[model samples]
Target: MAVQDRGERSRRSILEAAASVFDERGYDAASTTEILARSGLTRGALYHHFPSKEAIAAALVAAQSEALMVPEHPVRLQAMVDLTLEYARRLRSDPVLRASVRLTVEQSSFNRPGMTPYRQSADAILGLLREAERQGEMLPGVDLEELTQFIVGAFTGVQLMSQVYCGRQDLMARVSTMWRLLLPSIATPGVLMRLRTTPPPSVAGAEGDGVREGDAETDGTARPPVTPRAPWG
Candidate 1:
């Protein structure tokens, strides 16, 4: 049990370290030596848990998926929005994902596959939107899939823009502005009100339902085109 525990801890450490490295150095430039050094583990320890560098990168993304997924709160729709924005917040702030921000660009790679970080991210936010709509947080005419794409696109664009043109100070502000601009129109007032009442902004980070989602457009060969550029931008 102790050995197993150590192994698990080692794996987690590697994942966290990888996130840091990926954020700082990115996939193409990052090295296993750096990840090991960051984790304070030897190569043997890292290899015991993961087979290859690509596996480690994948593990890092999976870790981000686990850490940054949207929360399910008392008000379902706002929880959905809260979750979306929170993901936006983390993508902008978190180093591991900031590096993968490039992953947002090659839709062919993310869209083509068995499961990539961005796809999982898209699916998760989409699920929240669907739940919000089903529960009357959104009006009847809502198209959950299309709405999900709008959201995913907005997030992708925001992160990508910050990557390119951001002045380095206001990326967070930019992200929040995007969310504020989008949420008001997408989520219904009743749902929005209920969410606000249930979870004030202060404690938002502490609560969550622990569910993660994968993207809807990904199918291994090609991505489905469901959502257009958000009407907001």
Candidate 2:
């Protein structure tokens, strides 16, 4: 038990140190030696947990999805919206997620392994949209795959703009705006009315406002659920 716990701690230390470097320097400029130096671990220790710098980058990329996992909301579309808001909120503080995002954009600089982060994000949103469709929340005949890809692409553009404009300090607001413009076209009218386009205080400014993410409410006034309208001929 002691041996396993120590190994886990060491692994975590290496990942955290690597994340900080990657977030700051992008994948091409970050080095294993610097990661090891920041981790305060021997070369052998880092190599034991991660054989190469690419391996470490891959691990961080794979973990980004975990950080965005929101609790299942009663309204599935709301859950989808919350996932993006949570990601925007996390970008302010989560080194791993930031590093992963950096690596994703710099994919041309280095060989990124396994599934791309964009695909993973699309898959997650597609799952939520599928659930929302089952619950009659989406407009009929909308292409789930195409909509998922567009949502992921739109978010990528928004976050990049936010980062350039204000270092992602206003990313939550930007994401909320994205949903506001998107939901009307994709969601049932009643579902759109029930959804919140504003990021709750927690996602907008949890640290500054002293509100917890859990305290954010998902519910609005109940309205009769409306069936989706068929596509126009």
Candidate 3:
């Protein structure tokens, strides 16, 4: 293997192993030894990618946002909704996201030098909200910054609650309900009527009921054409 490719593989293995350890033991109890064992790598290999446990934790937290990727929807608000739902769905199976959430909530246990994961998540949603506003999907006078923060905080709580109650088996439904309650306050009346609370079948996985047929364009506002964007996974 090429030198760079071998190095990249080792780095990915270290991260994956660290994610599992963090997800299982959390930041306070997770150790470099455990991660090294999980990765089946030598001490040198592990340290080459991550300097310490804190560095690994920070990396995981930074990567949490990657799991929120979803395809662009014509309705920017719908895309925002899909973003949260996709995250919820991923929490059930994605170890990186789960570990990231664990490390984020347990921030006091470690030293996180850069921006917090919550801030990154809020920034992403804020960007979407700005687009929604430009497209006339949001209610007038809505403060995008405040709304973005609230959505991020609320999802954090909802997902944590779901995690404790049922191991996050119900996260998608809980997040769907979250959007249902909050959409009325922030979305235009026309947009509110047509926005889907549930994810589409392709993104929904097994727990999701998926979007119903005729669910789109039911608000009598002609579905505005949207420029296609790159798909997120």
Candidate 4:
């Protein structure tokens, strides 16, 4: 029992330590030796939990991406932009995510494993958009997949821009700009209220992306209960 408890503590220590170092130095500059010294773990132990630095990096990305899927809050956004904005906020706040962002921006290759964290994230956003369409929370005239990618990809672009320049604390204004530009077309006023009122809480951040990825893979067979929608889309 003691051994297992110690193992868990060591694992968590490494996770936190890595987050701190990566947060401070960014990913490419972070080294296993530095993470080991910070976490108070031996190299053997660190290697046991995460086989490679890239794997550790993937774990970090997974941690933040997972946060976006927490159960809907009362004041959360019901429209597509609102949903994506919540995710962008989480990415901004999370450490592993910042590293991933840094890596994606700095690195030039799609062949790298580092790309996987966000690889499926875009798909998840599109999945939710499709579900919104099915629930009648979206207009009837749009092409479902195209619109989903368009809306989601647009937010991704906005978030990347904000992250590259403004940092998370000031991101809301830019995300709000994206929201305003977007809302006029697809989101009804009622839908916008849900978004404006229900920004995702920090507590619910980083909880359920894997379940959602699975849900999306099954063609949303396990779609979450729809957030309340406006009377018109």
For candidate 1, lDDT tens digit of each residue in 202-221? Answer: 43333243321221111212
Stretches off by above 4 angstroms in model 2 are: 200-233
Off by over 4 Å in 1: 68-70, 92-94, 97-115, 163-172, 189-199, 204-233
- Candidate 2 residue pairs that clash: none
Root-mean-square deviation of every model: 10.3, 5.5, 8.1, 9.0
How far in Å is the alpha carbon of 42 misplaced in model 1?
2.2
User: Which lDDT value does model 2 have at 213?
Assistant: 37
Candidate 4 yields a Cα-based lDDT of: 0.59
lDDT of residue 139 for candidate 4: 50
lDDT of 3 at 2: 100
Better of 1 and 2 by lDDT: 2
lDDT of 2 by residue, 1-233 (tens): 99999999999899899999998888888888899899999999998998888889888888887876855688999899878877776776678788888788766456875357887888889999999999999999999999998999899899989888988877766777788777878988878777865554344444454423332222212323222232331
Instruction: Report the candidate with higher TM-score, 1 versus 3.
Output: 3
Q: Model 1, residue 185: displacement in angstroms?
A: 3.2
Q: Candidate 3, residues 1-233: lDDT per residue as tens digits? A: 69999999888888889999888887788889888899999999888888888888778887887876655898999999888877776677678878888877865658853456888788889989999999999989999999999999999999999999988777776887788778888888778778777766554333244422222222223334222221220
User: What TM-score should be assigned to candidate 1?
Assistant: 0.68
